[model samples]
Target: MEGGLLFQFCNWSTLLVCMVIKVPQIFALLSAKSSRGVSLKSLLLELAGFLVFLRYQSYYSYPLLTYLEYPILIAQDVILLLCVFHYNGSMNQAIPYIAVFLGGWYLLALQKWIIDLAMNLCTFISAASKFAQLQYLWEARDSGAVSALTWSLSAYTCATRVITTLMTTQDLMVLVRFLIMLALNIWVTATILRYRKTATKDE
Candidate 1:
């Protein structure tokens, strides 16, 4: 009974946090009228990772609670992507990206092996997304419009997922993904805070 309640708490809490996880970043962009510190590649890769993980869970009939937050995360990512494109004055360039993502979504379930392969690769893809963001921050040396709150909340969600995954599905792949994501999210959050501090000191 205790474990069940803890699982529910973690799952619901993760969902609740995910619902607004990207808001700060989106608001930051709109308020500043720039996407200076955001990485388009990171967003795209992260979207791809989410799509794969969500589809994998649904395809295998995993518990709904385990992956429920993914749709919300994906939606926010789409909105965030549009914001980034709009600010970068490259909205037209978004067409190809949209097309590819749609195509990949369909292809994910074409064969069981394909998704298995994708899931195995998902960690690297998601990790690449974090690295892309880290690279952006390193190059820019400025947080710019990036939201530290967004990344911190992301880390929180990931940490909760780690607990929920162990309590529920216990799928090694899923567990591994959450673990990697939790670490990367923390790393990104730290990087964002560091840059923000440096920028403040310079001012």
Candidate 2:
């Protein structure tokens, strides 16, 4: 029992640290004048993954642990979807992909025994989305309009995810996955600093 308590404590500690650091992302868009050069690819992918997450909720019977962030996710995802569309300079090509993503989820879920498969797909999707965003942030030279809060949140969120992945001992690939996310978080955190430096210089 003591061991369980210790595990729980460790999880909470990691969660708190990540959440506090992630708060900035929640406010970044609000504080920024615009989202000048942020890409939509990750957002699109996240939305796609979110659909799978939604399916996971249903598969898990919407357990107590799941709905913990339902409202937060709904609000955040709505805002992100809008932001993606707004930032996506190429609506013509983007829409088709987005549509296909949505359509594929419904099609995939049709198999009754595939609930776990669906959930796994969602995890893969969200993971891919975050990594893609991290890459984009790394490549971006000017974050003039992007919110610091958002990137900070991304870093912290990835941090928490790393902890969770480690704790769960999810699978053989979990180590690789955690390392990849850690690298992305570190890279983006560096990007945030570099961009902030240049942005400050302009002012």
Candidate 3:
């Protein structure tokens, strides 16, 4: 019973912390007023992955806590995408893409075979999204729009999730997912530190 309670504590705490970690990234994007170092492709791919996971969780009847967490992540990714559009003064251009994304998300959940395929594909895309962001960072090594604090928090969240997941669930897919996230976040954190200027010039 005590072990179960401890597992519950770690699970809730990790999810809660991960959810909170996005707030700063949102604010950072807003404050910088640019998404110069961010990868829009990565954000879009990650958004799709989030939607897939949310639907999968719903389909399989995951715990309510897990169900609730994905929406928060989805919302944050949407906000991040909007920030990108807002900074680029291309809100008009974003509408169609947003519509398409939502449309695809809705349609994907309807077919079980598609869902299974998307589940695997989205997982791979989600992991690859980090590399996409890393590629963007490499391309824009002169800029410091990517927030170190945000990525650091993300790394911490991923690490926490990995540990808690290993201890509690021991599910391979979930374990691998968070492990990749943790590694990518650490790489981002290091890249940020390496390239970040003491005072970044505005783009």
Top-scoring candidate (lDDT): 1
After the best TM-score superposition of candidate 3, give how far the Cα of residue 88 lies from its true spot, in angstroms. Answer: 0.7
Of 1 and 3, which scores higher on lDDT? 1
Which stretches in model 2 have alpha-carbon errors above 4 Å?
10-23, 53-71, 84-105, 112-131, 138-140, 161-169, 172-179
Write model 2 residue lDDT over 53-143, tens digit each, in one string.
Answer: 5565554554333223433554565565555455544435656766786677677567766766766565577677777766776677665
Compared with the true structure, model 1 gives a TM-score of 0.98
lDDT of each: 0.92, 0.56, 0.75
lDDT of 3 at 24: 76
Stretch of 10 with least lDDT, candidate 2: 62-71
C-alpha lDDT of candidate 3 relative to the true structure? 0.75
Instruction: Sum up the clashes in candidate 3.
Output: 0
Give stretches of model 1 more than 4 Å off. Answer: none
lDDT tens digits, residues 101-183, model 3? 78987887788988777776766888788888888878877435677787887787677667666665576776777788788
Better structure of 1 and 3 per TM-score: 1
What TM-score, computed on C-alpha atoms, does each candidate reach?
A: 0.98, 0.63, 0.86
By TM-score, is 1 or 2 better?
1
